[model samples]
Target: MARPTVFLIQIFAIFGFLHLGFGAPISLENPLLRQELDKVGELPGQNFVVNFTHYSGYVTVNEDSGRALFYWFFEAVEDSSDKPLVLWLNGGPGCSSIAFGEAIEIGPLLINADGKSLRWNPYSWNEVANVLFLDSPVGVGFSYSNTSSDLMNNGDKRTAEDSLVFLLKWLERFPQFKGRDFYITGESYGGHYIPQLSQAIVRNNLLSKEKSINLKGYMVGNALFDDHYDHVGVFEFLWSTGLISDQTFKQLNQVCANQSFVHPSESCDEVLEMVDKEIGNIDPYSIFTPPCSDLSSNRLRSRMHRIGRVGERYDPCTEKHAVAYFNLPEVQQALHVDPKYAPSKWDTCSDFVNLNWKDSAGSVLDIYRELIQAGLRIWVFSGDTDSILPITSTRYSIDALNLPVIGHWRAWYDNDQVGGWIQEYEGLNLVSVRGAGHEVPLHKPKQALQLIKAFLAGNALPALQLHSDT
Candidate 1:
């Protein structure tokens, strides 16, 4: 069933955008979105000097509603001006990219245990690309909207539209990045953000030559592409990993049939409760890692509800550092965060936005088809140990596309050791990271760096040999 969506039309009207029927983003006024004004002079607890410059500020997406999306842009570590620009998003549809993308995963700095200092990420993606991390929608991180209704109304369409508008305005602030090779990368729900935004860029690029965005390609890891496939993958991962019994597995398939993603049935919830009790406190996001034993059910429930089971953090209490660090007045001041905003404290994920997400396209596979056909460099990867959105789910979703096998399954290398397995499809490549969980870089930073290098260079992951099965 198609969504009764007039969101694009509504947004077009809001921005006075000419409806090209493909969500084209034209330059619009952003009174606060200016160049150099948003630059970060120094952080609250930084001890080391750096060559690259970075900025943190908001780009007003909707003037009528006062919706501004926050962003943290980091120039490349070396040859800063020459590198490609990579926009990173971390998805909960409501998660903070500044928290996950910038602080925890790919960003240059990691919050210290003291929650006041920072350490450099040796394998930060900025080594090769200028990375931009955004806190999208109105309610996530420092991004906010004055209208209360905006908080309750956000869904996929609005999020994508706002993000495209953000990029349009953002490029104006950093015109040096205007025609650079651009790529978007993220994990989990970013699965939706990257493709949808890519489609918008591709379609809008057709309207004008001077304003076109130079989008080269994009990638996602352990992403949520399709709900049906995801649900199937979850139950199967649970059973295969011995987290649930055989009988319970059968019950999950039966009682949970046709129930997937955010829309779960009553019977499915009941089944999940049983599975939850069986799984206990172990982190479902990474079965091998220890769970964050400190967080309350209130703060942790967002992920728990993602796959019908309780999940803890990949890094035990790592977000506490980010939460503590980002919420400080000094840090906020340094980042150019506007003081007046709803929900005063900073959090990694927004439960309000998650609960009220009004509309979500169930699958991005079709969007992938369109982008793939358009010759966009597309790649999907999985952190295999992530039972939350497992490798199995990625596999099932990719298989559903029925794309031609470009290369047989092969072992990809990092430092001559088997980092993971990879298989290439007609336009998409799927790679799995061994011993990695939902946050691939956090668990396997070196390998993650290698993966990014391959994807960005339009080169394949270094391989041992093709598998005999193909």
Candidate 2:
């Protein structure tokens, strides 16, 4: 088993000035702000990094009851004003976007062999658009609150509300980017996060004419969109790939097709057991470990399992590494985490952070429908080899949408070499990354970058031939 890695927690300190009533206005003139501004420079892949100097001391969700906190990381090309801002979140219901920033997509540097210091990535996302990676809701990453209750109870509703407040505060901090286009993108559980946040943005847009956040589009990669389709797809994929025996496939098909079946019941136990065994045997790196050995029992006890242990507690304001490499003396000094490698436990996904607010009724497909109706562009891409949220599951999810196909499934190529396949439907597009796993950018950076570039440019993906079935 891969050694456990600590989840790095990153939080921004609110300071400078207060505008009161409306919210706190961060002063760019603060000394720490000045220091951060001075630290701004070119990161790997020629991307410009500006430690967002704005302060968000306190965000009040309501005058009487609701409130949350957040911090932002902004990256862009130097002196470029017309680019769009893309808000990126990482799923975990508790994972930090900073983790995604450092390990997979963008930021500035990568953790070296020593675990500390920076390395370069030539294909960072900031090359095309301004990116804002946030640690949000309240306790994930660097965001925090004095109220202990705030740390323990949060769900999708609270997440969406806090995210909206953060966006508003962000706009207030960087007024120049207010009128610019904004897009929400994330992976894994973020598949849920982006849509919920987008829906909230739309509602706010409709409610307030004077102040509207112009949300352009949203995308999810290897995201959990629809539970029913996603679950079924996993079974089909295992069978089709010859990972399961023909007899097992037949048995599973019959069980799934039965219309009388209901969730959280004992009748489905045998099928679920088969699934757990197959999944565990096939891919040991299940992002969220299965709750029980019996699949039916796991599904029925999903709520209990989902609320698994929250790891060691550390101050949100403190800089800690989720992985040992990040906490190395060299890393701490280089990354600017305090105490320089002082053996601190990392919480990549905090169990203490409440996510009970996510409407149990809401499915990934439900959010997708809302986005389509709201006229928001959507893209769902998958890394073919990812067992966690495989391409088959994504295709299955899209099929249920019954989205009208604008273009048939065809190959996407680079340098005349077959790269992957693309299927265009209305405002939504689905593409596969050849040879990529759960983390596409990390696995196939060039292909991933090409796809992102084409999507951002609003161009149809180029056609390449599909791999022949021998």
Candidate 3:
């Protein structure tokens, strides 16, 4: 199963990544806006220079529930009007896409350590197409609900329904994007979100001929496939990678077998604790990279960094920087966040939403099958190093679908060097970012950009480009 690349995957994910710092937000003198621009504006301390424009605010998904979902939109670097629209959701079932997607992962800028500045991310997805980062499910990030019960009641089914409604209502605000080619992308738990929302869009498109979203396809990375496979892959990866002892791995499998991974039993938790201890003080998200060693600076805001590595060059301190930047009063006001929710600090992941998530479909394989049959451009990519939902686990789950190989497995390249590996199946495509963690784009921006661009263009990963050195 292994294919040799010119360079090791771990080195690319670590020393090869880029690291940037924050600058003050430049106030837009005459910020351009579409006719429906409500909270159209620039960040107060966003000092990075850019040609494209961005808009942010809320869309009420449910009036009776009084729940509003917040969103931040960035136009493409150039010719944004003609570019396709991509919706990005970060999975926590409760994490803020704004906190993760926008601030740290694929968004336009990475927050500075000062917590009051912004820096340009050269590989931001907005470079290719219009990108929308949504803080979904009422209580995540800047989104909230007046009806307290709505916060307590979020699940896969509800999130899918609300997201569909959010998309429809959001279109009303920017009707120009209504008929545009649209795609949804997310990670981790978003595996659930992408499929369910894509399925909803398909049903909606069939229902209404006049007002429908022109959804093209979707991509999910390092996603939760299903409980059994996810757990199996998690343990297997640890054992295979030599992170855990053979005894610990065997005990975990035996005791945790047929048990809930989400809410594991006492014995299972104990076994996991042993597994965690065996793995030791390394970042499980990206095992080879150095874990964030600084915690005292901003404990509350740093939680997001706990699960994964930070931006280019793998700045171990990005979590603290993001926490500081997002918590600034000026930044909050600039984003048009309601003051009522200010007392509660911004979080990368939501404890309430994660704990209260009401539903989890056993496996999205069925949904994948249905969507592939529907002829949607389905793509699944994985960060080869993610232990939580390892590439091995994802491979097992996708293999269950038995998709016929359209293109044989081969190494794909970027900048004329091997970036990762790709295998195209009849209805879907699977690509692996050699050294990335749970957040593929954060660690391997160049490769991730290439992956998304090919997916959006409905083409295969670019063939190896010849060079003088070669």
Using TM-score, give the best candidate's number.
1
Of models 1 and 2, which has the larger lDDT?
1
How far does residue 275 in candidate 2 sit from its true spot (Å)? 4.6
Q: Over the stretch 1-470, how does candidate 2's per-residue lDDT look in tens digits?
A: 33111121112333334232354654554433433432323322223344332221333444444444433444564433767787777766666676554444554455443334455667767666777777666666545555657766666677888789878865765667787878877676777778889988988988887545789788778776766676567567667766667776777666653321113234455665665665443221122222223222333123221321111111111112234354345533333333421224545555555343334323657777887988887888887866545687788879899989989789889767878889999869998878765556655677877877787777777775355659
lDDT of 3: 0.77
Tens-place lDDT per residue, model 1, 203-309, is 88876655447999999998988888887888899999999999889998888746646656778887887887788776777888787666534321246443222
Q: Pairing residues by index, what is the TM-score of model 1?
A: 0.89
Alpha-carbon TM-score of each model against the true structure: 0.89, 0.73, 0.88
Candidate 3: residue 13 lDDT (0-100): 30
* Model 3 misplacement above 4 A: 1-40, 295-313, 468-470
Clashes of each: 0, 16, 13
Candidate 3 local lDDT, residue 145:
91
- Summing lDDT over every window of 10 consecutive residues in candidate 2, give the lowest-scoring window: 309-318
Q: Which stretches of candidate 1 lie over 4 Å from their true place?
A: 1-33, 209-211, 296-315, 464-470
Q: Write the per-residue lDDT of candidate 3 for residues 1-470, one digit (tens) a residue.
A: 34223133223334433112244322211121222234445575666578887777778888887888989989899998889999998886677788878888899888876767788898999989899998878778788898888878887888889999999987876877879999999788788788999999998888886545898899999887666777787779989999999999899789875454445677777777677667777777777887777732322112221222233335756767777777778787776677886537886667787667677677778898889999999889999977877898888888889999989999988867878888899999988888998889888887888888999999888669876854
